[model samples]
Target: MIEIQGNIKTVGLTCGYRNMPIVSDLDIVLPHGKVSCILGKSGCGKSTLLRTLLLLERPLAGDIRFGNLSLNKLTAEQLKQLRRQTGVLFQGSALFNSMTLLENAAFPLIERAGLPRGLASELALLKLDVVGLSRYAHYLPSAVSGGMRKRCGIARALALDPPYLFLDEPSAGLDPLTSAEIDDLVLEICDALATTVVVVTHELRSIERIADHLVMLADGGVAAAGPPDQVRRSDIPAVNAFFSPQSNAAPLIDPHHGLASLLLDEE
Candidate 1:
């Protein structure tokens, strides 16, 4: 990995699109070399907060600090440089349909790192192997299952060996087993690479399985922030309502993707 160290700190952060705020006055610490999950109900601004942190969307208010650099203080060149140091796996997996998995995974290495195509491909293969997609390196994204495509997205994200990784809804649509496999890949990435990973997701099981630290948002601010088990045990009514359901019997569909199946699945 890129050997980045230090917590990503947000001071008085208020972010939303089109000037209206969704996450207001939020102060949270994303620790170095840990997997932090951002969880909340639909429209609660989990993704908005992440986008602002990634500098993909400008925050309406607040300051973000990574190491010694402040987001608002960075020049255009510094902004570009900061972006190149981080990796993002967008909700869609954001792959090129026309490229082979190898080519897709190697793209950032070639484009961002200025590596030769052959060398990029070689390094990309290693990343694919890390996500258990080495055998499918030659397959087109269209030819693989949705789960494989997500893993390929992960491979692509790590192509540049970035220290900070952001994933938006990493396991949004898939069977339970597939989602769990993706969760395994996430754990492996954090443990093996020691990358600071931030995920925006609603999957309770995935959170229980992978989250080293957790931040739960409600009412445009932090309802809870800490370790997963501790956060789940919180007495906040919204938090109780959110996690209390996990103890109940899971429905016919996997409880994780039950927005269409039932309640507490929204977001």
Candidate 2:
């Protein structure tokens, strides 16, 4: 893993796409070598905030600082150089369907780091082992299950041994067991690589299992920020609603209730 250390700090951040704002006047700190989860309801700008932080999308206002560099002040070449310290796993895994898992994982090292193909493959294989996908290195993404594909995405993200990692909805489409496995893999990555990991997700279970720090957003601003347990216990209505656990109650209506009536709700 790359030897990296730095906290990500935002000052008066306002983020959005085009000219429209999604989140405004936000400030948060992501500690070094920790797993921070960005949590929120749908349409609450969690992903927007992350994209702005990753320098993928420019913020509408405010400044983002990583280590000593101001993201908004960097030149194109400088930004590219700074980006080498980071890796991203997109929501869909985003692997090339035609590339073998090994090739996919090794692409970053070859393209970004200018390593030889053979050496890149060697490094990629080690990353694959880290994510428990070493045996599937030769397979195409299409040939792997969704869970395996996500693991391969993780392997590729670590191929360059980045000190900072960003994952968007890492467990989005998996079953409960598979999602839990992915959560475990995420924890393992943070521990083994000592990477500063930022995960954008709404999966409550995953948050409870893996997050070391939490930033919860409501309507694009911070509703709460703290450790997972503290955020869960917050009296803030939005926080309470989001962290509330599922109940084990059966339906109150008769099993034979008509679909239309159920949909309309009885007066």
Candidate 3:
């Protein structure tokens, strides 16, 4: 079993921009080797929370830790090292228009890791193959469908073999079938590689298929945080509404099992 300290966690965290808080007093735990998704409507701070964890968005208060490395307390060198262990796929897939899929995937190995070009290309092809993009390795991002581009972005993110991967809106512009494919790939990555993944999205179908744990945000804080079933059963109207958008019914809340305690009292 994974130890509590080995998981990525937040302590009384407050995330925001320009001093305006988006989410406050958060104590979230991303269980080691699991897929934990952040779910909410637009402006609910799902992406802000993720970016805070990545240190791209500065936290207004509180602390974040990945294993024993405290985000707020790290030395510059340590922080840099920590960043290397993380990979990210931005909302738009962020691929360079000029680079072929293979070249884009290999860019990190050649530049960030300083690997030789030939070896990097060989390893990149393997990553592309993982995403079923071997046939499109030579295609530019503009030449492929949005789903394919997203897949390539995912491949590039995996090139560094980071233990943690953060994906933002991975199914944003895709059809239902393509969204399902992305969900399948996420599950495959988590199960086969044992990579801890944090996805920020409101795609219900994708979330249902891939999320092992859920953190639902609303009213500038966590509405519910727990296993998918438990969160789905939350009495919080927004949380229930998300899981059952077609109706106005909401499940009963177990006051004995408040969400804050899930992290506050973790062993």
Candidate 4:
């Protein structure tokens, strides 16, 4: 299990080549074995926070630690080992276009684990089966639907069997039905593998479905952090506004009841 404590302790966290500070003085602890969602509007440092945690970007000030290992204390070799314990599913289904689904999934195993091609392919097939994409083994990214491509990305992320999974905007761009399906898949995978998942997304529907814990980001910091119900009841205006359905927001559909309601109405 991953335990983060004593706050993120960031006096200044920046982004980009100019080193512009998007989020500053940020402090939070992401508990282990929980499905935590980082909610924020676009350009509100959500991605920056994720990158900071992964050590992809060096902070201008402060520090990050996981369990007992502080990011500052780890050498290059140690940092690589630490990263191996985490799996990241990037936004836009960032699968390589040239590689088949099987090869895409196997890449991590080969590169990180240094496994032979035969063994890596065997492991990749197992992960593909877990993601319900076994039939798409030979298919390239272009051949599959968007949802399938997302699943393929997930399979590739899981290739190393990381204990923690980070999903960046998992529900972005997908239709509501497909998004809900992805949520269900995330829940299923978490339960089966006992993985801790940290999802960064703005979709309220996705939050309602998959968030075991919630952290709302606004004004360059966390607005609230707790269970979903507790977050809904928060007195903070920012929290309420963040979760409130916007005028153009997609209608909240109960995944289990939607089909039934439609079928019964048609009767």
- Winner by lDDT: 3
**Where in model 1 is the C-alpha error above 4 Å?**
1-4, 246-267
> lDDT per residue, candidate 4, 156-260, as tens digits?
988887777889998899999989988998898778877778899999899989999888887777778878899899878777667674634433465457465
Model 2 per-residue lDDT tens digits across residues 1-267: 223359888999999989999999998998888999999987899889988988889899999988777877877776776688888888899998999999999999999999999999999999898888899899999999988888898888888778888999999989989899889988888898888999999998899899999999986799999888888888887887777635432334655667745565465
Tens-place lDDT per residue, model 3, 1-267, is 122235789999999999899999999998888999999878889988988988998899999989988878888887767677788899999998899999999998997789999999999999999999999999999999999999999999999888888999999989999889888998999898788999999999888899999988988998899999899877888987888877874434553577744665455
| lDDT tens digits, residue span 1-267, model 1 | 223357889999999989799889999999999999999887799988988998888888889987767888987877767777788888889899999999999999999889999999999999888888899999999999888888899888888777789999999987889899988888888888888899999988899899999999988999999998899888887787678766542243565564745565347
RMSD in angstroms between candidate 4 and the native structure over all alpha carbons:
10.3
Candidate 2 differs from the real structure by a C-alpha RMSD in angstroms, to one decimal, of 5.1
Off by over 4 Å in 4: 1-17, 245-267
For candidate 3, the lDDT comes to 0.88
Model 2 residue 68 CA deviation in Å: 1.5
What are the TM-scores, per candidate, against the unseen true structure?
Answer: 0.88, 0.88, 0.89, 0.85
Q: Candidate 1: how large is its RMSD?
A: 6.7
Residue pairs whose backbone atoms clash in candidate 2: none
Q: Residue 129 of candidate 4: its Cα lDDT?
A: 94
Worst 10 residues of 4 by lDDT: 3-12
Which regions of candidate 3 deviate over 4 angstroms?
1-5, 249-267
**Residue 170, model 3, lDDT:** 96
Q: Give the top-scoring candidate (TM-score).
A: 3
Q: Local error of candidate 2 at 256, Å?
A: 31
